[model samples]
Target: MGGATTEPADEKPAVYYANCAEAKRAGAAPLHRGEPGYRKALDRDGDGVACET
Candidate 1:
């Protein structure tokens, strides 16, 4: 029998954005530090928010 796999709530998914523009276009801007698709590169000021204008 195969077991089901689950991801941690605090873990980010495979989603990724090369830049803020992409995130904004995708309507996923202003990503929190622990949110899915949120990356350190996106957080320019090292703040919790990402893609902030």
Candidate 2:
């Protein structure tokens, strides 16, 4: 008798980051909430805004 083997699934989601300061040379506009840059720039504490506070 043959049995099928099952594999465990990945629990962690993929993460992305915004452009670095070096990339923009400090002249790039700031990112706001709900933006890609904001998602990468701000540090979340308990699912709330941390960097802005």
Best by lDDT: 1
How far off is residue 35 in model 1, in Å? 0.7
lDDT of 2 by residue, 1-53 (tens): 57986556865443334444432444333434564344534544434332343
Provide the global lDDT of candidate 1 against the true structure. 0.87
| Clash totals, every prediction | 0, 0
lDDT of 1 by residue, 1-53 (tens): 67988899898658888899999999998899888889888888987898988
Span of ten consecutive residues with least summed lDDT in model 1: 11-20
What is model 1's C-alpha RMSD? 4.2
TM-score of the candidate numbered 2?
A: 0.25
TM-score of 1: 0.70
TM-score of each: 0.70, 0.25
